[model samples]
Target chain A: MASMIVTDPSSAAAAVHRLPFARFSNGLISLGRFVGPLHVCSPTTTLPRTLSLRSPRSSRFITASMATEPSAKVIDGKAVAKQIREEIGADVSKLKEAIGVVPGLAVILVGDRKDSATYVRNKKKACESVGINSFEVHLPDDAPEEEVLKFISDFNADPTVHGILVQLPLPSHMNEQNILNAVTIEKDVDGFHPLNIGRLAMRGREPLFVPCTPKGCIELLHRYGVDIKGKRAVVIGRSNIVGMPAALLLQREDATVTIVHSRTKNPEEITRQADIIISAVGQPNMVRGNWIKPGAVIIDVGINPVEDASSPRGYRLVGDVCYEEACEIAAAVTPVPGGVGPMTIAMLLSNTLSSAKRAYNIK
Target chain B: MASMIVTDPSSAAAAVHRLPFARFSNGLISLGRFVGPLHVCSPTTTLPRTLSLRSPRSSRFITASMATEPSAKVIDGKAVAKQIREEIGADVSKLKEAIGVVPGLAVILVGDRKDSATYVRNKKKACESVGINSFEVHLPDDAPEEEVLKFISDFNADPTVHGILVQLPLPSHMNEQNILNAVTIEKDVDGFHPLNIGRLAMRGREPLFVPCTPKGCIELLHRYGVDIKGKRAVVIGRSNIVGMPAALLLQREDATVTIVHSRTKNPEEITRQADIIISAVGQPNMVRGNWIKPGAVIIDVGINPVEDASSPRGYRLVGDVCYEEACEIAAAVTPVPGGVGPMTIAMLLSNTLSSAKRAYNIK
Candidate 1:
C-alpha cells in the first residue's frame, strides 16, 4: 500500500481542478475548490480516471505533490466521533424540547467479563454525552436464569426505557437465547434482536437500527465521499456482529460484496479484486500491503494487541492489516484505534435517541 | 449446458470408483461394492457430498444402478410427504385421543395473486390430510389496514390457531411490513417472521423453522450424502425467499459461500470456482456449461416456463441453468420441476406438523 500525500500548495490547486462534481453535494464541491492549496494539485495530472460515483470527487482529491511532512498522518477518530456526538447532542436537545422526553438506554450485563464491563461503561458515558438516559443492570456470575429473565421482564414493562443492550458472552450455564428473546423488540438497541437481524436480511425492508459498528464504518466512508454503489467490496471474516451483516448492508448500498473467511483459499486473490476492503479478522496483520489494490479505501476492523517492548502494558494495539505498508497503497485508510472503535458507541447513542423518538411518537 | 446420460454402465462404474471416498460415509462405501445393477453408487459418485447425521435405520436406500429404472431410485417426495402426513395424522389423533384438542393453522391472504391462492389452497389441503384444522382469511385487493390488523389480532388471541402464514406480495396499497410484524412469533411457521430470520443469521443459533424452500434444498442434499462443509458454494441471486438466507445457512454449515447477484460482473468467473452451484435466478438458461466447474453439483431453484407446444399448458418448466448443458459438464443436477419444487411443499407440511406438535405439547 503506497499512499500519496499532497502537502505542497501548488499540487492542491491542480487536485481541486480535477475533482468530478456530480456525486458530491453542492456544498462539499464548493468547499474543496475554495479551500484547496495550489501545491497539492501537482499529482492531479498524473492520477488516472475511474468509472465511479465519486470519481469527480476523487479526481479533485489527487494532488501530485507528496506531503513533505515525514511524520505519519494520525487519523483523528476521537475528534470525528466527537463532532458527530455534538451534532447528535444538538438533535437530542431539539427532540427533547419538542417531545418533553429524552432517549433512555438500559444495558444488562450478565456475569463479569472485563471487556464487556468496559464496553458498558463506555456506552453509558456516550449516552450521557448525548443527553440520553443510561440504565445499568449487573447480575452475579452465578445468577439464575429466571432472575435475568425477571430483569428483562422489568425492562420490557418499563415505559421510560426505550432501548436495551444485553452484553454478550453470558455465563456458560445460562441460555443466552432465552435471555435475549426476553428483551422487547422495540427496546433492542444493540440491534442483535432476531427481529432486527431478520429485517436487515430482507429486501424492501430495513432494520429499525443497524448494528452500531458496521453502521459506523459505512458512515465513515459516506462522510469522506467514498463511492460504494456497484463497486466490488470484499469483506474478510463473517462473524454475526461485523462481517455478515456488514456485507448485507453493503449489498443494500448496491455494492457487489463477496465475503471471504477462514475457509477461503487464496483470500488475497479474491481481495485484490475489491475496490473496497473491510478486514475484520482479529488476526494481527493478516492482510498484507500487497493484498490491497491501489487506491482502494481500506477499513481495518481488527483491534489486536502486538507485543511492544516500549510500552508498559507489554503490548500495543494493532489492526488486522499492516498499517505502515497499507498507508502507502490505500487512497484513504481508517486507523485501528481511532477509526471504527469510537464510532460504535456514538451510533449506539444515536440508536437510543431514535428508539426514544419512535417510542414516544416524538418524531 | 449439455447433459450426457450415463448410458455406458462401465464408464459410470469408472466415475463411481474415482469419487473421493475418504469423505464418504461407511455405509455408502459398503454400498458401493455391491453393484449388481442400478445402484445408488453411480449418482452418489456425481452428487455433492456433505457431512450429516443420520440414524442407522436410514441406511435403507436404492442404488443408482436402480436409478436406471426411474421408479426404483427416485426419492419420492410426494410419497414421502404423504407418509409423513400419515404419521402426523396419527399424532394428531393421539392428541385428540388423550387431550381432546386439535392443532390448527390460520392463513391470511391479502391479495388475489394466483400463485399465493394456489399455495394457500395446497396448504389447507395438506392440513386436512394431516388431521389439522385450517382457518383461511381472504381480503380484497383494496382492503384497508385496520381490517387486516383486526384479523391478525383475532388470530393471535385464538389459541386454536397454532400457526399463521400471511401470503407475500400484498397489494401495493397495503403495508407488508406492518402486516408481517403482526404475526405472533410463536406461530410464525412461514419463518419470514423477523425473530426467526434473526436466529437464522446468528452463529450457534438455530431458527425454530428454517425457511421451507431452502431447508428442503439442504435436506435433499443431506439425505443424498452431498458434502457441504469446507466446499466452495456459489449461490446465484440474493432474494429473501431463497438465495440470501440459503447462503447464510450454507455458511453456518461451514461451507465457504459466495453470493452472485444481478450487480455481480463477470459472474461466470466467480461461479466457475464453486464446487456446488445453487441458482435461483428465474431467467431461463442464464447459467451455462462453461460457468460451472467439472463435477460440481447444481441445485436449480428457478421454476421457469419454456415453450413446449406438446405440453397441455403450452409450456414446460425450466430452470435458470440449462439442464442439458449443466448435466453434461457437472457431475450431477436436479431437474427443475421435479427437484426443488416438490420439496418446498413437503417442507411446508413438515413446518406445519412441527407447529402442531409444539402447540399441543405432543412428541
Candidate 2:
C-alpha cells in the first residue's frame, strides 16, 4: 500500500471546484466558519485564507502568502486540546467557587486489557488537570456482568458522581448492549446510549452528551478553523463510536456527508469528491495519496499498531491514513497520535463537567 | 403552476438515460424490473416499459409500442395499501389460530381538534378492517396532563396492548414531551421513541418499529418494485416523522440521499439530481414540474387542504407536488389523496401485528 502511493495538489484543487463540492458547502463550522465566498484560484495565486467566528465581535480574517513551503499545515490537536482544558478548568473553578461542588467522573473498567487500562489512566489524569474529581472501579475479566451493573447502579445513586462511564469492549462473554443500557442516561458520560445518539441526529433536540471521540474530532476541525457547512465530507468507516457519530455531527453542522464502508462501490471516487475527509477505519495506510483531493482538510481518527524494529517495543502506532502522503495533498491534516486521541479525553472531561453543572443547576 | 406544464414521453426517456436514474432504479416495481439496458429510442417508435419484480416467477418485461398517447403512470397508494392490509389480515388470523393471540393497538387522544378526531376515527376504522383490536382514550381540552399520563401508564402495563400511539398536538396546557415519554418504548407503534430512531440511523442496528408514514412510503416503492440501491434519492423536508426518517431509510437501502429543507439553497438543483423523490413538506404545490427531472419516481406524502368548492366538500386535498404537472413529467407518481395517506395507517397495523408476534415469540 505504501509503495503504490502518490499525491498532487492540483488534482485535489480541481476536485474542490466541481459542482456539489462548491455548491454544497454551507461554511458554518462551529468555531471557525468562513465568511463570504470560497475563492477558488490557483494554489500559488490565492493567499491562504482563514476566517474565524469565535464570536460576533471577535471574528478575524487572515490572508498570507505560503511561499515558504508547499506542504500542508499540521493541525495541532494537542495545543487545541490544552486550550479547551484551560477553558474547562476555568468553568470548573467557577462552579466550585459558587456552588461549593466539584465535577466528578466515575469510570468502571471490567477487563485487564492493557490499552483499555491506559485509556482509563489517561482519562483520570485529564480529569485532574481540568479540576474535575475522578473515581475508579476495576474488576477482573472473570467478574460477573451483574457485578458491573451493580457498580453502575450504586454510582447512579451517588450524587457525588455526576458522570459514569463504563469502559467498552467488555469480555465477549458479556452482553455489550445490556451493560451499556444499564448506565443511567443522565450519568452516561460515554454517550453510547441510543437516546443520546437519537437526539444528536435530530434537529431541535439536544443530546445530554455527545460521544467523546466524535465530539473531539469536530472540536479539532473547529479549533483549526475548517469550514464545514455545505462542504462535501466523506467519513471512512462507520463505527458507532467515531465514524457514525462523526458523520452525524458533520451533517448537523450542515455538511453534506457520505459514509463509505467496505460495501460501498467506487469508494475512492466518492471520497475524492469530498472537500473534507475523515478516515476512522482502523486499517493501516489504507488511504493512499491519489485517493485524496488537493486542498482538502483531513482528520485521521484511526490509530493502528505496525512493526518498527528500531523502537524498543518492536511496534509503533500509525493511523488509518498514510500521514506522510496526506500532508502533501491536504491543506490541513491532523497527525495520528497527537490529533484525535487527546481531544477525546478532553471531550470526556467537558461532558463530565457539564453533567455536574446540570446536576447542581449551575450554568 | 398548472398551465405551463408539459410532459413528453420521449424527453422523459431521454432524461432517464442521462445518468444514474436508469442505473439506480432497481426496477422491481410490483409489475417487473427492466430485463436489459433501457433503450433510449423515441417514444413514438417504442411502447412504454413497465418492469416489475413482484416475484421470481412473476418477473416480466414489456417492450410494447406505447404509440397511443404520452402520459405518466399514476401510482395508486389506496390499492397498494389494501393489498398490504390483506396480507396482514391473513397473518393475524394465523396468529390467532396458532397462539390464541390477537394484535391490539392503543391510541391516546388529548383535546378535540376536528382534524385530530377525523384521523383517530380513520385509524379505528382501519384497525377494524384488518382484524386488529383498537383502544381509544379521549381527553377533553381542559384535561390535566397527568390524566393522559395515567392512561399511557395503564396501556403500557396492559399485555393485550401490543402497540401504543398518542395523537399529536395535545392541548397547549399539556407538556407534549413529558406525555410522549410515558409511552413504554416497547409499545411505541408510531416509532417516535428516540431509541427507535437512534437504532434506525445506526448501521447493523434495527429500530423496533419504523415510523408509520415513512415505512409506508418505502413499502409503496417496494410493492411497485422501485430499485433503490445505487439510486440518487432526494427527500424534501426534514420533519422528524416523515422526511428525516425517509432519508435515513433510503440511505440504509444503499441509495445516495440528500435532504432538502427550508434552509437549503438551490434545493431545485439537488432535487433534480434524484431518480427517486419523497416530498413530505405540507406546502401545497411547492414542487413544480421543472424542479423535477424527467421520468423520476415520486412518493408524495403531503395532504394539504386546498379550496375546491366545486362540489360538496368545499375543500380538497393536494400534495407538496403540483399533481397535474408531475403526472405529465414523472414516469410514475402517487396522487395526494390515494397515495401516502392510506399507507400510514396500514403501516401502523403492520407494526402492531409485528409487536404481538415478537411478544409471543412467533415469526
Candidate 3:
C-alpha cells in the first residue's frame, strides 16, 4: 500500500483500485440513521452519547433534488485515505524495526450491534494493513458498568496498548460519560475526552489527538490544497464527534466558521455564504443546489442509509449532500461513501500511530 | 452594597449614585496602556501568557477624543455587576444562616505587580461586600512554583473553602498551566483547569465552573437583554480567560460565533459583519467606526489605558472597542472601566457562592 493514491475511477486520474467503503458498507451507511446517530460513533468513537441531527418531523425544509449532474472535481476520500494508510504503513514498519515496538490499539465495544461489530472488524483490518497490533473486548448489552470500566483500566495500564477507543453508543443502560472518562487522557486516542477538546478550543494549546472524522475532513481539505484561512466556512450539525470539532479545526485554520443547526434560522442562507461547507447532518438530500454557493468546496460527513429497490442490500449509502447538485455548483465535493468514510478509518489509524510514537518517545 | 444597581447616570433609571469605576480610576482607565495588559489577570487567569494588544511602539492608534460624545445606550456593567453582587450576597447570607456555610474564596497571588495586587485587593473587598469569607496568600515574585501548589492543595483540602482563584501573570517565572492544573476541579472556582474548559466545549455537558471574566461578559449581555441566540458574534481576543471562553459561552447560547485574533486578516471587515461584538484584544482604540455594524450591540472586553494628561493617573481605561465610535454606531456599548472589569469580580462572587452551595448541598 505504498501511498495508495487511489485513482478515482470517475476522475481524470482514472486510477482503478477497489474502494474501501464497499468493504465497510454497513458500518458507514448505517451510521446516520441507526435508530439514532448516537449508536454509530466517530472514526475513533468514544462512548456514543446520542449524536443527533434532528430531522424535523415536518420535512418542510427538505426539497426534492435533481442529482444526475456532475461538474465539481471529486476530492476522492477513499484515495486520500489509502494514501495516508500507505504512509502510515511505511512509518509503522520503521518504528517496529527501530524500536522493536509495533503501535497497538485497544477497542472496547459494548452490546452486540452488528453494525458496530462490522466497524470494529474493519478497524482491526486497517490496523493490520498498517502493521499495528489490535486488541478487542466485546461486552454484552447487559454488562454492568463496572465490567466496562475494568477493561478500560486494564487497557490504560497495559504497556502494549498505545491507544484506547471505546466504540460509541454503548448499551442504553451504560453511562457513556463515565465509561469515556475512565479512558486516561494519554490513551484517549479518540480525542473525545473533554480536556483534549478544551485544548482544541484554546489558543496556544494543542489536543493530544483530534477526533478522527473531523480530523479527516480537515486532512482532505489540506490534501486538496483548499485555503481555509480567511475563507468563510459553515458546518452543518453540532455533534461533538464531527460538526463541533470540524468547526473548531476550521477556525484554528483561520476560517471564519458558522454552525448551522436545528435552531438556526434560514440555514440555507447562512450556508450559501461559505467558501467551504462541511455538512454532517444525516438528512439525505437536505442541502439543495441553491443552498451552496458556486465554487464552494463541500465535505459531506453524513453516511445515511437510503432505501433503494435497485440495490441487492435494499438500501444505498448516501451523504447529507445532494451530491449531483453540489457537484454542479461546488468547485469540489467529497463523495459520501468514498469520501469522509475512508478518511475516518484512516485518521483512527493515524491517531493510533501518533499515540504509539509518543508513548515510546520515538521520533 | 444591597443590589448595588449603580444607577446608570446616563440611563432613564438615573437614580443618582456614585460610580465604582470612578473610584477605581487608575484601575479602569489605565487597563490598556498600563505599559501592557499582562499586569491584569483574573480569578482564573491561567498564564498571563504574552497577552498583548500590541502598543505598536507608537501610540498611533490613540486619537484625542472628547468621551462626552455619546449616542449608544451604555450597558452599565458596573450597575449590572453590583446588582449581581447584591443578589449573591443575599444568597450567601441565607446559606450561612441555613447551613452555616459562608462561601469562602481563596486567592493566591504569586507576584507583587501593583495592578495584579490591586485586583486581588478588590476581590477581597468584593468578597466582604457579599458576606463571603476570603483567604489571601501573597507570595513574592521569586517564590517557587511549589509554593503556589502547596496553597492550592491546602485550599482544595480546606472544607471551609468553596473556591480558589490564582491571580494572573504568575511572576513570569512559574509554569502557569502546571500551577492552574494543580487546582482541584471542585474548588477551581477560577475555572482555568483544562477539564473545566473541556466540559465547557462539549454539548450535553457543563463545566464545574466557567472562567470569571468571560462569564462576566456573557452575564452583562444577559442582564442588558441582548438576545444572543442566532446572533453573529465576533470575539476579538483569544486569551484563555476572556476571548476564548467568551466565544464558547456565546456559542453555548446559540450564537453563530467567530473569533478574530491578531492572526486574523481583514479584522475590520469581519468586525463590520457582526450583529454582536465582544472585543477583548486589550488594544487601545483598535476597533474604529468602520469596524462596527450600525446598531450592533458591543461588549467591550478589552480594558486598555491611553494617555490622558487631564487625569490624576495621567491615563484612563478604554476597551478594545473605541467607545466614542461604537457609541455613535452601536445600539449599545459597554464602557471600559465600568464594563467588563466590574463584572469579572461579580462573576467571581457568583461562582464562589455556587461552589459553596454545591459543597453544602444547599439549594
lDDT of each residue in B158-235, candidate 2, tens digit only: 999999888766788888889888998889888877898889887678999998888988988887777888677888
Alpha-carbon runs more than 4 Å astray in model 1:
A1-76, A96-101, A106-121, A133-161, A166-182, A360-363, B1-121, B124-161, B166-179, B308-312, B360-363
lDDT of 1 at B279: 81
Rank by TM-score (best first): 3, 2, 1
DockQ of 3: 0.41
The clash count of every prediction, one per candidate, is 46, 22, 8
lDDT of each: 0.66, 0.70, 0.71
Give candidate 3 regions above 4 Å deviation. A1-70, B1-71
The residue-level lDDT of candidate 1 at A185 comes to 78
lDDT of 3 by residue, A1-363 (tens): 111222221111111111122211112222223212222211221111111111122223222233333446688888888889999999999998898888999998888766567667878999999999999999888999999999999999998998888876678889887988899999888788889998898767899999887898998888776778878899987777777888889988878777876556567877888889998766655676778887788998766556566868656666667777776677778886798878877888899899989997876
Docking class of 1: acceptable
On DockQ, who's better, 2 or 3? 3
lDDT of 2 at A85: 94
Candidate 1 lDDT tens digits, B174-283: 88779878988777776766668778888767787877767766766676556787688888777776777778788888677778776666678889988878887555
Ranking by lDDT: 3, 2, 1
DockQ, in order, for the candidates?
A: 0.42, 0.28, 0.41
Better of 2 and 3 by TM-score: 3
